[model samples]
Target: MYDIQTIFQTANPILNQMPYPMMILNPEGIVLAWNRQAEKTFGYCAEDVLGKFIPFIEEERTYFYKDLWQKIIHSADPLHLESITISTKKGEIVNTPITLKAFTIDNDRYIFCQFNLGSEEQQDLLSFNEFTSIRDGLESSFMMLSIDQEGLISYANNLFLKYSKWTPKRIIGKTFWQMFPQTPESSVVADAIWKSLQNGRQWKGEAEKITKDGQSYWVDLTAIPIFTSAKKPSNFILLENDITDKKRLQNRLEKIAYIDQETGLMNRYRLEQIVNTMISENHHFTFVYFSIDKFYSLKELYDDQAEQVLIQEFTQRMKMYFQDSSMARVSIDEFVVLTPLGEWFIQGFLTYLEQHPIYINNSTLPLSISGGITKYPDDQISFTHLMKASYAAIQKVQSEGGGSISSLTKADHKALHKKSVIEKRLLVALDKKDLKVLYQPQLDLITGKITTVEALVRWEDEEIGTVSPEVLIPIAEETGLINDIGSFMLEQACLQAAAWHRKGIDLKVSINSSVREFRDKNMVKQVRRILEDTDCPAELIQIEITEKFALEAEAETSIIQQMKQLQNEGIVFALDDFGTGYASFRYMQLLPLSQIKIDQTFISTIQYQPKSQMLIQGMIQFGKSINMSVLAEGVETQEQQDILTEFGCDAIQGYHISRPIEAKEVEKLL
Candidate 1:
């Protein structure tokens, strides 16, 4: 056998000369020997480290090596190879696998170890390669930086150098604060990184960055802190991703969602959101709801293609007039503009729209709009209330005739309140049976005998005196109470007319039906049921509808056909408010009728305006030629009465004959 002393000495030299790290400890866990590889791996030579506690390698190693020594001492077993991380003198971390063996020499216990340093460098090289591959593969502009605890940038990638307008030589030693000094105080990136380093955590978020060229960009950043062998932070690794294009794309999508596709203006959905937001914020603003006049007719004349061109041209003209106003397309033919402007500006804009004509595809389309304006915190506070007021104003202008714009005034509010009151009372009145029908007799002009009775609706409230048909009728229509009220009126009228027939008075009873009631698909069925229940002849019930009903093509066709069907069953149809609408002559030719009731307007102005008299005469002649009877309404004077008789009017009705009377008074009148 070789000499033990020589073998030990020769093996010790080879171990000390090895390029890897190695250490030897006694059974009591004291550092007995260390090799040159250990010195290079740990930045400590054998002289300084020998005889020191092996746990002194790191704070974590204190418990780790202590347990290893205790296990070896108690069981006399060697520990298999294991991986561990330790700190070097320069504060660099080295991960290595180590093996320990228990040996004895001269009756003393010792633990020998072999450490591998190349394993850690191989891992670090693989990680570096992965980082470079990831950085190069990204399509978006990006940056990577490694920062030390003292805030000095130790490394920067190629992309970072390009974006910072600096080379790696200049940026490697510079701090972030030095690179971008004008960064806003609100920036939390540096603070977040510092917090992560102190707490050994990770952080990520989007941050605003200002470049060397003073241009601003958005970046998404992720950062991780590197730790030492003692589990204390040493440095930070940061990855930055440019997200400016993503932000731009998100903003563009949001804009597309809220804007109208054709006009590129705010859509109704956006308008509603704005109105609700304003109400929630209690901001004062004004809104104008406007509908283009003759828009439907124009749409019918020119198809959707031409209509789109007209709308674009109209929006351009409106923008020129309103300037900075926020406009939106609220409906197919309606545009709403919300503005902080006063009445003068709104009025001027309306006037400008009224005067201009949209030139669309070689056609000069007349651009006229009827608008209703309501102000916030002044007209109403609730969004729904404001919208109602605005729409009410629009309806007012539409009813009075188009091509006009009106603002909600004190009188308008008072009128709305009155209507509201009437609507409430009308509901109660229906339940309490407070609604009644009054009769105005229509007399044969030649024989001076009552030929028919006109049924007029009347309501008496306990709080307010009497509500006129003009006021209560519209309220009922808007509130959808017309169906109930009309049913009551029809039942009452039929019952009273049946009572007259019981008295052997075979006269037709005429009852006015609103356009809303007349257009109902169930009106004919309901009327037939009423006649059957009251035991009255169908011929005794004459239903009157206004001229405005004929203007709506689809609704009018349905109503007229239903009426003709009922008339063929012996009921009669009469056109009320004659010569008041655009298509009266066409309606006369198309509808089945028994009489034409001249509108009160022409009758009221006949004595003053010759044009009114001539129009009435022409209408009376047209009625006679069609073999239809003509009745002049609003015949309150003998002069008016005589003129109607001279013009060959068949019947007349107004205050002159008899004001509307209740069912009891109708018996005396007959």
Candidate 2:
């Protein structure tokens, strides 16, 4: 420690004698000091650089240098490290890693610095190699071309030169229209590209291009806009690929799938797809399915070639009427059309087709077609239902005698009357339990003592009190409410029969079954549940089915067989409304019928109508021959009962003794 100032002054020379470039700049950006390493690295002598302003690198490649300086100077605590590029004399570029430190000596600012060039040169060299390798190895027939905002080419690549058949020097700065003067300016593909560029959107399409030799070919081109940092498009990039053969194969496949080979119209598969799409999109469209009237007979009358010619001529005439429609050949003699029209337009079009006869192969074929028409978003919610409604309507027309167009109206009056009366009351009845079971005591005619009772359903409406079962029962059957009503009646009757069993009466009761209820797949299950719930002997519960309901038991053969099996367990079935329909005698052998109830129509007329008496007598004799019990219904007069008793009827149930009584009232009778 001999003379500290002298020792510090001696250490300064060694600090500045390092092998790397080093310089210190003041806060005012003036170069205050430099070393011999700085002089050699930057190609400036220390005497020439010490008092000069530091060179501001203005090259676009080194623009970030200004930003780096501002960041360090304005920061409250200046940073000590940064890497930057600087331009040298002789147009050479070098990168340097620098370390800086700020120190204040005399209330003014100062900075100390260090510099190194150890690893930066290697990084620059590696970056340059990667860029060149990628630029040379791309093989997608890519071209780097720049286009001005005014649609003029400013640059072109080598690949573009060979494809355009023009030298790069000549075509680099030409506008597209000027280079290909004969190209169609108003073509759809060209207009799309121009529109995209004007709107600053990317455009892609197949376009026709002409070479310098005037040879034309198809090319798929994609044009993308190059955006600046401000997000405004500065130029465009156009990439093209040859696609002629690909397009030809696509067109051939489409023809095979959609075009009808015989009629040259759209095939059924295409028509179905179009209809499905239209329905999915909720489009307002009208569909019409039609078939040639008597076409099968016409084919028999004429030869195959003649029929073909007739069909073609018929289709042509149909096309004339539905010019703006989608026409398809759905079958040999059936055609369908999808149009955007109202009912009036469709009716008028069909009328025109019906009135015009076609001339085919030097003969008048006099063809006519029957069609069904329906509108979209009105009649159905899907294509399947639309086709179903149309076909059902078309079948209705053809079955009544073809040769006219038909449209679906609301359900017919009979069906509506049935549905309205039944569905409205059945819903309310189920909630209110408005349905009551009326028991008509079935007597042994010989002893005149009640042994069994028939359970008849009587509807007591709150507003319209006590509706006759005849009117409401048919209504219920047609609306599919009969199954519910029948089950309710069965449950009530079983409970009453069980109560009668407890009272030592042991009287069996029967309930009527409708066509719908008898054919219901769940009929046996419902019956089993009620019997099990009530704990009634199965023999004490009989199901009374009408002769008309028995014929509809085809699909329910297994159910009918189940009923017979249950009959073996002591349940029974009576064929009610006997002699009311045809083939009553035939069904007796087919059905396991325990009893036959003669309808009231013949019973009330036995006094005046001799034919009624004879029919009743014949039914009784028929029942006797079959060894089946015959019960007479609607006996309103004692003379009628005496007549039934005289005829040796098994049971009598009518107003002559007592109308159907409720369970509570029948309990008193018991």
Candidate 3:
């Protein structure tokens, strides 16, 4: 057992040096030691907390201490918890972050909890009194409100009243979530807020809300729960920051990336993206590559300006006919259309084109339109090959005397039927339990040990051998089968991690989720159910979500709430494939992420490219600034690992560590 006198003599210097409060508690939850900072923070001297069970362990919340202690004692790992409740000597409630590490000295159990609450000076710097200063204060646009335990708004800041268009009379009694009309529809968001607040945890996320004018807008919201001295819920402080302008800018960028300025049609790049999506989803559509017949001669007949006008007229005509199709200009006279049309429709389009003529300046221009048509899933299924096949048919039409539509021949149908059958079977593969979950070790750069491994899914058909994830993952996303696959992976990963934990390994397993899973309304409940079914500790599971997951506005609230709930249960998130998409800092500010995995594209060239190294530096710095772990993906060489470590990457995963291995095979490495 630890001798109190000896412990003080040995730890006095270290205890006083800590800037934040540091308290030592025994296994029974009795505080044994308190530093100067602790006194300053809780308004309690060392004598006040020492020999006392942590001041306000509410009877209902007592399990929180038990669970936390059990996790640390069994896992032998230091656990950091945020938004813990505490009561000061003055009988005031405070929500502060605490990190607890279990230790044994001479067979005695103790937990050292470091309270990372900032100094009193810092608190004063942001106190409510100063915030009351209108003109120079946090004046601004952010709405702030305080909600009492009864769910009534007890206080509203100036900005909150201004935005609600209410004089204190109308706003005072309204609940925080009911401030606007849209709040009632977001039940998932409201439940999370109420649960987290009553439990002494903070809830934050971006959700659309209705203003007094009945206009909808997005805001970054945060609500911190405050408790009374008796450990009963008192109220919550909520802050809302308007992010409409940021989203508008992102929407503007989305347009610039996909639309063609000249023709008001989807650009070539966007057209390719659409084609790829269609192929992945196994959607059948007709692809037509056509050009005006003898366009050079036709353009020479008119001046340059007149030629431009004629081209615009032809596009207008095509637009009139292809209402539901995606069309784009490939060249001066070449245009392509991807339509969900059949042969009958194509023939009708051809006939319609023959009956009409391009009229400019009240003069008829006799121009023949020829098209080559190929069907997805029936002809060449690969997007690029489909495009080539359509062009070939177009050439065939021009050779056969123009002014016609030509269909894809045997050249485009090579093995098409077999591939379609295979795609159909692959959808049911997960249900049959034919897919495999493999693990690839990730090394902690600081510790130089394997701490986490990503769970990757693999599939092999009885008739067709191994299927590449690259091929099937996209198909799964498009066909809405990813949710099934994701759930399976999560269950398997948890089961495997649980097995490792049985061996006292404390391994963390990473699972990837598609945007579709986030879109599912029951995602949060689903995740909790899987954890219970597998008996997997939430702390050992990490979910990886990508930036593409943020494209849809409606799904944002669900995703953010689910992530927050799971994270509060001790699950961590990774911004997978970072730097590949929009890479918005908004996600970093709002999402409850633990790490940022630098995309391989940036790390692969870091050894030789100065720009790549600079980008890596910026990412690492950004992660540090936001208190997130920096991990590098696809590190294949010692030199690359060294460079990443030199720049402060916390962990790394790639072939350099080891390719994904089967669960049984992982034992040898362990």
Candidate 4:
């Protein structure tokens, strides 16, 4: 608990220095301290307000005040009451805006209030009568100067001399314009001020002036022309407040907006600004994007200081080579340049990189730069299109194994733009339930029974209709949206299977899983959660993966552990498109696969090719020898099904059985 004396003693010196009027009150609305500015604004002395209820709350506004105070107490943001009418000590009504904030000191809460005596807009100095009435009140806080009709300083006060670092004798006879040099910006402000004063009008603005020691400072200046008895101007009086600290802070923030902190180069925003300016002028230039290969690995190998030194050294090398270009660091490892140089520029840089490698940390780091080039007015007309084209070209170089450069082509840009659109809209499709799950039945070849169906994802977007799985799956995997899409498919499939189970149909639904989806360590937990939420039996769900995914999963222990956990929960696992990739045969011993589906390529050719039929028979015998069921996909004719049935395949799924259909259609088929 704090006494009133301690609160006042701790808050007095700081409150008095503030430019605005301020007061401190206890949580119970008793006034504790009022600063000097408040006394000047409201004509109330501190002695009259201490240890008493607030004196300004009108009887008609009691409810409004209570509500505003309650908001201030409960919210972290300050509450602002604008233009509240109040009566001053002289019984004069005035409209003032006040801001209130709740704070704590010594475990006790208090409300701090600030009064805005004037509106935020810049206002001219008061007239002669009002100025004289408030001159004494303003003298203590403002810097004052009086200039004659000749623009020579006629009088300067102590505050003005103190800030300008000038003595009385040296400053009294000097011209005002001499203090501010005739720079482009200063000349404009000087003309405006002179014109306003000559017209007998007041002028208010911020100005930059030099001190005696050649240091510069900014001031919020207001100048009023003093008129004589004949209504003619005699002199002008200027009042100013030093705003040097605020201007310095703003300058620093502007520098940060354009400069990259790490390498002292321009940032992406500055790069875009320069490019847009060039485009507006119709200048022909080439845009080049570059990235360091395997930068993350190198960053992990080095310490922070070594990494910073390496990047700085790289930047220096680039600056030295591309002397005529404007460069920017867009990301940690990526950089962009805009130049008038043509194809030879990129080829020459490649040769230069080969001759010189970046050296740091007492180690020779093998460095290679991957770049993409696009020309303005040739490849793209706008800055945004040029940047996208350059990025697409760089992606091509990276996809072809990095350390080279590529130029954007019309076809390549179109395809990349389409893929980018799909990547962005795929998640939105999932959220809006625009994607659906379709089921394809697998017939048991031996019993002539339909016991299982494969769950496939299908999408028909409003903008781009009917995106096939071959195109959509790769985009989803590259953008990492496959995890969300995979989850959606699993939940929908499980719900359908649970519904079928309730109708006395023991049907198993197979969902394709990606290696990227299983990379998540929570996959097993996610599977359990979906099963519990849908009330579906674990045995009714089968997860399918391609031979490529199976080979990749064999080396990842997390994927193997998650698979075994799901297997223990009675979920089935199958390898789809088994013969399409590296079978490794080691997956047979390592993975908990219960079934394998032969790819359609071999199945479609089995009737025409003797070698394909022999291979299909061998695969069936191999699967059965390991107690795993063999299923053949894409059988279209009765002859193809007969051949697969004769080969002792356990099941077959293809056009011969049925095409993939929706859940309700599958129910009708059952």
TM-score per prediction, in order, is 0.47, 0.49, 0.45, 0.63
Off by over 4 Å in 1: 1-329, 332-373, 388-434, 445-448, 462-465, 473-485, 548-556, 577-586, 598-624, 636-649
lDDT of 1 at 639: 94
Two-way lDDT contest, 3 vs 4, winner: 4
RMSD of 3: 28.3
Across residues 1-670, which tens digit of lDDT does each residue of candidate 4 receive?
A: 1254553644465566555687877766778878888888888898878877777767787677666666666665456677878788988889988777676544566677877662265665666678889877777778898999989999888888899999889999898886665588887887789889989988887899888887788888888898757476888898888877546534433344455656777887678889999999999998999888888888887886666777888898889889978999987789988889877877588788767777777777778778989888877776777777888788888888888888977887677668777876797898887898889999998889888999999998988888999999999987788998999999999999999999999899999999998999789999999999999999999999988888898899899889999999999899999888994988888889999999999999999999999999999999999999999999999999999989999999998889998877877766
Candidate 2's clash total is 0
Worst 10 residues of 3 by lDDT: 118-127
Better of 2 and 4 by lDDT: 4
lDDT (tens digit, per residue) of candidate 3 on 583-648: 457766677888889999998999999999999999999989989998999989999999998898
RMSD of candidate 4 to the truth, in angstroms, is: 15.9
Worst ten-residue run, lDDT, model 2?
Answer: 118-127
Ranked by lDDT, the better of candidates 1 and 4 is: 4
lDDT string for model 1 (507-583, tens) is: 78888777677678788898889889999888788888777765553345787788778888898878888888666
Highest lDDT among the candidates is held by which one? 4
Comparing candidate 1 with candidate 4, which one achieves the higher TM-score? 4
Whole-model Cα lDDT of every candidate shown, in order: 0.74, 0.70, 0.76, 0.83
TM-score ranking of the models: 4, 2, 1, 3
Clash pairs for candidate 4: none
lDDT of 2 by residue, 1-670 (tens): 1132232222234345455576655565456666677777878665665555566344573335445544555544424344666666655777777655444433544444556561122111122235346655433456445678888888766766666677777777777554333646525566678678778777765667665676565566667676655466777766666554444433433443365555778877678788888877878988888888888888786675777787787788778888888989877788888998766777675567657766655676766678888667766555665666777678888998877788777663234334455567778997778787778877678878877888888777876566787778767766677778877888898899898888887888988877666556566777888899998888898888877777765345775676677687788888887878757355565667888889998888899998988889988988888888889988888898888888889888888777778767766765
